[model samples]
Target: MDPHQANAMTTLSLFAHARALTAALACFGAAAIVTASGSTAHASPPASKKDSKAMTTSKPCPKGNLERSQCMIRLLLDDVAKTYDGSGGGGISAIRALNTTTFAVSLPQEGRIDVLTYEFELHPDGRVAIKSRTPSTQNVGPGTGK
Candidate 1:
């Protein structure tokens, strides 16, 4: 073959290789992004408001005690205010139980008193049970108020 023709073929081949390589790299980058997005989608939901506040404000509970008791109190108070139409007339009270931690608040209005008592029981799995009691008896979920 002529030298000019050979050189032209070589240049075309090199260009093709470069385009293929670029396409491969782009595919890899897209795959990585898709994989990361899928993993995040499947991951656990974001922390609740109470959980975040607890981590930020409360001291770490002992290995055998309730975790973030102070934060729990704040969360409960906020819940009470929301539930009672911004009428949070309760005063918070805390006491150490025989083998647990107890927090109580009294909401007195007119002639009715609503008591919110949270009994915290720490388990081996590092979860706390915040049992809230009102005059009508409502159970809030773990790590949340109201």
Candidate 2:
């Protein structure tokens, strides 16, 4: 093979290797981001044995269980909003807890006034289970409600 041709082939191979390395790095970076976000969303304080017993026997919030629940829901909703993409105008608006471990969140979609409801289950082990449902649009007449 000509010396010039051999040198050209070597350079091409080097460029291909570099491209592969770059792609691998990009994938790794994406994976890291996903993992970090997931961890942040699920991170919670671990309950000790005594705390677990207290939780089981403790009385519900006296001020108003619903209000207390709403406070917790608001915190979770805030986190969701922070993580959500706001460029599309689709994100969580409110949240309500139906029970100690179950809660629902309201999400607004792009170009729509209706809020979608989502259910989430909070586990003692810092795990969160989320379920999304189809959203219905709000109906409004032409002249507004004058």
Candidate 3:
């Protein structure tokens, strides 16, 4: 083949190779990001033996002999789980009573290190409602830690 034609062919080959490499790299980068985000989406820690035992030992307050506050907390946690995760998986780690009808709760969410704090109130219809919520990393409300 002519020198000019050979060089042109080589250039085209190189361009094609480079384009294929770029596409492959982009696909790999996108896959990596998806994997990372998927991993971070469910950021709750694995349950330890002690934590598992604590969960098992603590029965649902209505059927068992647990305290009223404990039962209400369990129900609240269930509600939060339903609202946030669509499944009954998450649990509140800490709860502090603001008053007989109001309280603050702290729990961890997927992809976050800091706990989320929410103010909760018992409605007149016997339903629990979250009044307000704030992230714990910022200087916010009372239930601020893990």
Candidate 4:
């Protein structure tokens, strides 16, 4: 085997590992922010201790603009998971701040077969007010390309 090929393989493995680690870290950060901040998935906070633990705590956004934006994005991901069907598992592909209160986020495809992107408008408070489900063009994938 060529030394170049071996190097390429190792590089690819490292890249994959890095991506996995980043995903895991993001999930953990979001969970901590949600759990410790008092954000709830339901209408209101749970009354009992057991039920309270089940709820996502919500707190005011961080004072720093950078921290606040990150918090909002994490909260938005939690909201997106509610409508996601566990397809693709790619998570959020892109997010753009359209305005002070509105953001356009690109969602992962429904399945591995399709490369479609769904864009939605999410508020800074993590409330989804608008959603667009239009598929773009035919996605090209390995072994499925024409």
Candidate 5:
């Protein structure tokens, strides 16, 4: 990725994180909105209205890492919680295309499930349709269920 584009992505991601922080803080006025372990941090409000227009499901995604940026992932993960097991618990970290069409999404390390990666592909019709979700394993760790 170009340095400028990388910078822009960083800026955009920071802005989004800030926005999430603001919304989270403002929502409850307490630090409970964010968790240090990241095991249970609440998601911020949806991107602003203009973000919808900026992020279209069409080809030629905006500048930056189109395949990995939050914009693309957010748009694609509209109903991610519906199918991705254990997705409801932790946050998403990365989205990498294993091939031209297949993508490997990195999920947060839940208790006893470290380095879990899910490979999926979107429908050719330009929608968030998952063709399949086969996972590759790594290792596990102890986690507090409390």
Candidate 6:
């Protein structure tokens, strides 16, 4: 695929990952508050009263070998978690190679499972570019998602 198409696919993949992560973290946060309250049932805090705008942000994919690419992705995931007010569990669960130029990574933390699959290719300039991505919930099974 052309570089532009590859970048578009990569962006979609990242978006899926971030959306799942955000939802999972939000659920976890709500659960934590409830558990800490110790049976004193309380209503969830109100949603933001002000208008919320979507954010469009991008960062250059880290360069180098596959291992280094995996490391960089992991660190980026950790940073994203923190941005959503969530904590990381120190490391990811797995970064499995799907092929010589593709990988499937799993990040399990705080009872949630997130999986990101992507193909990477090295540009002529030596920068690693993600060719495509498909992110989903790892723990979700058939008969779920009602």
Model 6 C-alpha lDDT per residue in residues 19-103, reported as the tens digit of each score: 4444433432231111111322121222231312211122244443423343334333333333333245323444455554565
Model 3: per-residue Cα lDDT at residue 46 = 25
Better of 5 and 6 by lDDT: 6
Q: Where does the lowest 10-residue lDDT sum fall in candidate 3?
A: 32-41
Alpha-carbon shift of residue 124 in model 3 (angstroms): 9.9
lDDT of each: 0.33, 0.33, 0.33, 0.36, 0.37, 0.40
Better of 4 and 5 by lDDT: 5
Model 5 TM-score (2 dp): 0.36
How much is the lDDT of residue 60 in candidate 1?
A: 28
Candidate 4 per-residue lDDT, tens place, 1-146, comes to 44333222211001113344235233433222221223322212212223333223233554443344444444344444434443444444444444433344443443342222333344577443334433333354565443
Name the weakest run of 10 consecutive residues (lDDT summed) in model 5. Answer: 28-37
Candidate 2, which segments miss by more than 4 Å at Cα?
Answer: 1-112, 124-126, 142-146
**Top candidate (TM-score):** 4
Query: Which candidate leads the pack in lDDT?
Result: 6
Candidates in descending TM-score order: 4, 6, 5, 1, 3, 2
Write candidate 3's Cα lDDT for 1-146 as tens digits: 33333222211001113333233222322111111112211112222223434222123232221133444444334333333431221333334444443345544334333344445454454444455655553233455533
Write the residue-wise lDDT of candidate 1 on 1-146 in tens digits: 34333222211001113333233222322111111112211111222334544222222233421124433433344344334431432222111122234555444333344455555555555444555544333333454344
Instruction: Give the Cα error of residue 79 in candidate 5, in Å.
Output: 3.9
Evaluated at residue 136, the lDDT of candidate 1 is: 38
Residue 79, model 2: lDDT of 37
Residue 38 in model 6: shift from native, Å?
46
